[model samples]
Target: FGKSANKFLQKCGVKNEPPAVKIAELLVKSSREVWESVGRDTENYKFILQKLADDFNNIEENPDLITRMKAEPILLGVSEGKKYDLDSVENIYINDDVVYLEIYNELSMIPKGYSKFLYECLGCKSLSESIKEKVEVSGNTQETKESQDLQKKLDERAYLFYCDYPKNFIRRNEGWLKKLKVKGIDKIEAKYFMKAKNNYKIRPVTACILEDQEKCIFNFYITLKPDYLDISKCLVMYIYKSRKSREINYLAMMLKAPLEDLKYSNNDANQENSQCGVDKTEYDPQIDQNSTNYDSQLEDLFKSLRTMFEDCDHDYIYHCLKQQEEDKLINVENHLMEGNYPKIKIPVNPYDPPVTIKVGKTFMNVIQISQPSLGSYLNENQTIYCKNIKDYSLKFEKFLDGIEFHIPKDIDKSEIFSRHQNSLNHFAKIIKDLIEVFDCAPKFIRIFYDKSNLMAFNQDRALFFNFKIYLDLYKIEPTIDAMTYWYMVICHELAHKFVNDHNSEHEVSIS
Candidate 1:
């Protein structure tokens, strides 16, 4: 209904009418590109394609969905050396006419208006009296019995979908094709795998039922043991139809693309937008907490820095943070010129300890960085500066070897001691085990209360070779799933110590 739709319709020369037979022509052309030539008797196939297009138009469905389904490699059967993939093995159209007709009707992704046209193409009479006369004329013949059996099978076949097809077919999986690589930031490919439990039992449920595009009935997860599936690995199962009995009777599964690819792409996008920066110095960790002088663009800079740090695109974020420092210097210069503030140069050595500076009678702690590293630095720096570690960990008896758990001074320790003691102990054990396994060398791991998500890593890792990690103590509750998830996040950050971006090197390090 927009430019993409309009352009497709224009190419088909059907802006004022249903796509009709042109849809079949497009399919035949596309099929030639992927498989051997199909639909030699194109005129004979016209009735079904025309009818399908008219049915979709009559139902007011977007023409794109039906057209896309027809063009994709959907049919599969045991035929040649390439065994199950019809889209890849050449010469699949051995009996072009029969297979062409079968393509329009015998599909799990069959267009809503297609079967009736297929019925007509089979030369069934349109009206009841005409049908009765035809049945009588062909009564009890072998051909009639065969046709009747075919009709019964068609009626009994199930049509299950497994994707939320975006408009113009964006991110739509090429049906049955094993994904060779990971792609798409908005959604994933390899549509039909279900989420599995420890036992890997599966049940199909309708997921993503868009009114006109597609429906994903993801009720099964045919995977190996749950232990084999790592959360950090981002496992996906690719399920496809195998033509064994009639056609598309048996389903086969293969594992494909990891979800870490999504995070990598997301970080790439963030770098493009914020142009990447990092703090080359440590700060007081509390300077910008209650400050209201920051504008929206500056706020975006802080947000970008946080996201990039989390994403592990360190170099790009370092440049962005450097720009932030330069802006602060310009402001400081203007203030000193107006006699509103004393001139002072904050050290940028990055190894310098935080020192107090006076501004308008306010003695605020500032990390003399390349002059600024601000609030986001503290938010993720892992040291909550809470003097309450010994008091809060009264209930956490299992002491970590290389980790110090701290509750930010702001959180009510008494409530945490009473309510979240079990949770703290549960997550603390996970951290301890992960550290032992990965040889993690962080000085302290802080559990602080944040709004939604949590992160780790000190703003300045150079100081005492001290890397710190922060966990959102109250972000997610103490559950098996939550523990598994945080374990992956923690491992991911630790992996950054070896390699930052999720590349082959990072993958190997994580592995």
Candidate 2:
């Protein structure tokens, strides 16, 4: 035997030197700590046997294919708060320590087309079967019932390995978790409920981790739907084990960090990096289409902005006006020194429209009065600006009555159309929620243009207002910090609709 084979046998606690194949079997059965000892010594073992072992163990406990089969009806039953047909549940005993539930239609109940997708999408490991066959090849010619049962268990494990191992492996290397955090930029919490045609709803637990230290974010999602007996168990599992389930556990191993320690890794580095003004061209949406992982990307962008404006904080609207002032002052000083435009200086009015406002330039829209007045100049501009009005629709009736405003000409229609798709994607779920609550849909939602100090216009409009997030703020922090801007915009705009009714007055203080 070779030196690696001898070391493998010693690490596995086998006497003498096992054959090359036997050594491989022992290595497959060994724990990571044991395998690491051998792995450190030589690269003879190509496959990650320890990971495969984990894959097998994970399948034995939570066979994803089986779990998915069970999940469908259970999700339906729980959503309806009724009993699932017992025929859909199956209990299979593979061996002493490997008992798993297989979900399938009863003899009378025919399997549906969707079942195929579920089955295919779930576990499908075959390598473990080869490993098992290799291990038991010497004496398994009898084909007894016990042997058949063992074979069945091994097959099940193999299928599961096929299903989860690749995903687990990809997630570890490609930074899937990191991507999730980016997807959920402005959303603090999100609930993913999948509804089948039959009104069966599956509540999937999702967590988007922004692991800055690891330069990755983990967007973890899992749905477990077990019938009556397992419903409580599912809930219990979610509470105690779901976060640390095999999927996440394997992911943790790949990250080289424990689940608990991994919390700090969440997007803080991305957030901080974004705040640092190192590079802006890197995450430009026009240049990189794959940059649409909004959550982490936005966070990074805002972090970049924070880095640019040392006095400002992550929350965009809260400190935007101050930052804008500082920016204008810097520009004025530059102009004065270079003699580019000695006459041009920072505006005395913080929210005044710029003399040379363009469609894409960034600017802030501030109603300068100390307090927003319903009857004063605030309401006058609305009538002057909006020329085409047949009758006030219920959507903007109250808002129109409260405000008079003129839309800025600098707002670009093309830019609005271009950015609108993503902004709509950002708030689609929230819009759906509102639609459900109100029981009505508007004819259209219009996104306004960019100003000199802020990329977009006033976010106060009928039923909704749209605006652009300043690129400068994003340039500083990059991706993670950019998310703060999106959230602030959403919160500020939504507040108008949510805080009080049309006639009711609330303080509209803009800092």
Candidate 3:
């Protein structure tokens, strides 16, 4: 175990523990805490804890794995003064510049005020440069090198911050120009120009120039759609001029051909006729081919531009212009969950039809069932079985009559029928007790016995207990109790109704 494991176990109430027992105790305590917090039985938690324990032991033996584990921050689920599940934390990596952490899933178990903790665990400011150096010295293949190059370009081009466009604009020269300031840039000048003939709009162009120290740094031209509703479809042309050559070159052109037609037609005397006759060429075959090739190259340039600016935050420009105020701005955090436990509001009436509500950070519908009846098998013999059980033995009479259970005798030929009945009654009582402990009882408890060799399942507010496998096993094995198994299955399924997560691991832990 490393310093992180030691610190976590201490936080989880496992202080003064031997070094050999520290890791095991941490896994067990954390998992048990998580299970209890979610109002679930800790049966399934053992599997996850055992796996983590094995991994921890393996890492201790392997020097390289131990080093990697130490470098990465352990994500712990903290609730009610206890930590649970160290493996639940996603691995965060620092980029080459070390300016930000690359968090893959933002909804991961990174607690608030843990940024400093992560930095401490990482130990070094930057690991990206070392990783890159390793790859280079080891001789990366062509595909790996190409991918690295592309990623480098993307990283270099990525913007640090984005803003929305201003709301107010006065249309001049059939268009308008809006000047805005970027954080690092000294001056950014923008213009929107339109070309119209015979009351028909021909060209809608947006141009921007960025300057620093009286020298132009970037020039951009965007050709908007005729309606201009879909900003995603707009064509953008970025021009770059080299300082050494004093020559201008196109950096990229997004959605190019449509804009090219407007560009060529705008220069012609008769815009409508020239645009219509763009494909037509003079009778010299070789000259016509050469001209066609040049046009093809221009279209290729536009396509290339799309790739260059594919990940660029164009939405920022639209947002900046539309909002026009800093206070009204919205970011990715507005749409994502920022806390450990999602804020869940359970209605006063548990039996009411599930209503759509915000759970955690996201909005979702939760289905609640009140007084759910057990399946047909148990319901069919409810009156007859209750009467017979009362007459058969006074010992079983103490159990609540609210729950009805049916166990098929054919499940195990050697087991007595009365024993099966007694075990089921005991199981139902345990479930009720567990529910009372958690204070999350449903409207009703229903148990159905089936010989399909299936596991017990809880669905749509009802529990179907398989008599063939689960019931028979509980009778045969003293270690396997009906109460614990039933509680585990019920809690597991109830969590699904609450959060609706499809993840098996999460479902297992909750169960």
Q: Which stretches in model 3 have alpha-carbon errors above 4 Å?
A: 1-401, 406-419, 440-443, 476-483, 498-511
lDDT against the true structure, each candidate: 0.30, 0.27, 0.31
Residue-wise C-alpha lDDT for candidate 1, range 43-90, written one tens digit per residue: 223333434433433323545544444445422223323233333111
Ranking by lDDT: 3, 1, 2
Angstrom error of the Cα, residue 178, model 1: value is 52
Off by over 4 Å in 2: 1-407, 410-444, 452-464, 470-488, 498-511
Q: By TM-score, who's the top model here?
A: 3
Q: Tens digits of per-residue lDDT for model 3 on 1-511? A: 3433243334334444234234444433454455555354222333233234323434356565445545333333323233333442323322221111111122122222222222223232222222221000111112333233323422332221000101132111111111222111122222221121112112222222234446523222222211121111111111110010101111122222234343332224233322321112112221111111112222233233323333222222122223223322232123112221122222132112344443342111222442232221223322111011111110112224465554454444235355565665555555555455343443444454555434444344554444444455565534235545555555554554444444676465463
Q: Could you report the Cα RMSD, in angstroms, for every candidate shown? A: 34.0, 32.4, 25.1
For 130-164, candidate 2 gives per-residue lDDT tens digits of: 11110001111233343243233322222222221
Which candidate ranks first by lDDT, i.e. highest? Answer: 3
- Per-residue error for 259 in candidate 3, Å, reads 99
The full ranking of all candidates by TM-score, starting with the best, is 3, 1, 2
